[model samples]
Target: NAGVTQTPKFRILKIGQSMTLQCTQDMNHNYMYWYRQDPGMGLKLIYYSVGAGITDKGEVPNGYNVSRSTTEDFPLRLELAAPSQTSVYFCASDSTGFYNSPLHFGNGTRLTVT
Candidate 1:
């Protein structure tokens, strides 16, 4: 089964545009997350879902939104894209939120806003 898959490996958006970064997992995990990383920096959580119909904003949720309608899918939305939002976006999932639970990550979506 595909652990985690993210579409649009790369994207270039003009200012004020909007986009959705798709993320799907087949692991039936209860916890899913979206994170973004700027060049040469650690990743920062943008949004997360504990389970279907349950979601919450993460550390940097200002320009994004997320929804988890099922255990296998969690999609992130970006509104009014800006240059500062240009970064490598990663989708991750884990069976548990514990520190020892292994986190599976997508290849990453590289977005560039001009």
Candidate 2:
């Protein structure tokens, strides 16, 4: 089964432009998340959803938004992209909580906002 998938392996955006990073999973997992990883650091949670139609903001949710209308899709929206938002974004899923389960991650979307 496909765990999670993210599109646009790499992208370069100018300041103020917007883009949505796509994420989809086929594992039927109840938990989906969006995270950003800087050049040399661990993943920082951006947003998450417990299930369809229920979304929540995470640690670094600023300048970002998310929608969970379907179980398989949880796209992250960057309304006004800034240089500070430039990082590798990853989509992950977990059948259970972090304490009991490991997350499955996509290759990642490398975004560069100038």
Candidate 3:
């Protein structure tokens, strides 16, 4: 089974265009996270969820939104895509929210907005 999966491996959008970056996992994880990494920078948390129906904003939640309606899916929405939003986005999950739990990361979705 796929531990985690993300769609649209690459994308390009106009300044105001919008899109959804889809993420799903088959590992029955209780915690999931969305992160974005800009060039020469570390990953910044965008949003996260502790379980189905429970989500919270993360370090950099502006310009984005997330929902966790099920244990298998957590999608990130770009309301109005911007040049600053151009970054590599990743979705990760762990069975538990413990510090020692190994995270399963999906292949990143590279987005570029002009």
Candidate 4:
């Protein structure tokens, strides 16, 4: 099964353009996350959902939004994109109630806001 898949592996957006990074996991994990990595800065959680119809903000929530309609899908939306938002976005998921379960990650979507 495709553990986690993200669409549009790369994209470039204008300062005011917006886009949604699509993520889906086939493992039926109960927990999913959206994270971003910047130069010299480690991964920062953008948003996460413990389950369907329930979501929460992470370390950096501004300029971004997320929705978890099903355990298999989690999409991250970027509104009015900016240069500051340029980074590699990743989607990950892990099964709940399991300590040793591997965290599955998408290949990552490289977004550049020019």
Candidate 5:
């Protein structure tokens, strides 16, 4: 299984710009999630999807959006990038029926918005 994969491992954006962070998994997981990790901080959930066409906002969904149209893809979009949005973004997923299941994270995309 390839787990999760994110593109553009690093990025620098100016304020007000927009970008999409791509996420894909080959493990055929039914639950996928997007999270942001500020410097020295724990992961904060941004959005999640239980399955295709079923998505929900999370703790920190502001300035972001997500769509899960298939079991293998769940991409996150930042509408208007801000410095406060500058953080390491991670894409994760886990098997269904395992509420306590640990997430499989991608390498992470380090974003810096100035």
Candidate 6:
């Protein structure tokens, strides 16, 4: 089974546009995270959740976040999009909360805001 999958591998958005980047995992993980990577930069956290119905903010403010409501899906929503939001976004999940638990990652969704 695919550990994790992200939809719309590439997308383009206009200023003020809004979109949801879909992330799903078949591993039934309780921990999930969203991250964005800019050119020549490291991954910047966007948001994360320890389990369904719980979510926490990260460094970047993509927009308001929501609880997964299900362990298999975590969608990142971007509102009032701007050029600065352009980047490759990644979604990851860990079966256990342990620091050393293996992380499963999606291929990544590339977004461009014009």
CA lDDT scores, all candidates in order: 0.94, 0.93, 0.95, 0.93, 0.93, 0.90
Give per-residue CA lDDT, model 6, range 1-114, as digits (tens).
Answer: 989999989999999999999999999999999999997889998899999989999898556364598999999988688888889999999999797998788999999999
How much does each candidate deviate from the true structure in C-alpha RMSD?
0.8, 1.1, 0.7, 1.2, 1.1, 1.1
Shift of residue 88 alpha carbon in model 3, Å: 0.3
Which has the greatest TM-score?
3
In order of appearance, the predictions have TM-scores of 0.96, 0.95, 0.97, 0.95, 0.95, 0.94
lDDT of 5: 0.93
lDDT of 2 by residue, 1-114 (tens): 667999989999999999999999999888999999996778899999999999999999999999999999999999999999999999999887669799999999999998
Q: Model 1: per-residue lDDT, tens digit, 35-73? A: 999978899999999899999989999989888888998
Candidate 6 overall lDDT versus native: 0.90
Error of 4 at 106 (Å): 0.5
Clashes (backbone N, CA, C under 3 Å), per candidate, total 0, 0, 0, 0, 0, 0
User: Which candidate ranks first by lDDT, i.e. highest?
Assistant: 3
The 10 consecutive residues of candidate 5 with the worst lDDT sum are 94-103
Residues 65-108 of candidate 4: C-alpha lDDT, one tens digit per residue: 99999989999999899999999999999898377777789999
lDDT of 3 by residue, 1-114 (tens): 878999989999999888999999998999999999987789999999999999999999999999998999999999899999999999999898898998889999999999
List runs of model 2 lying over 4 Å from the truth.
none
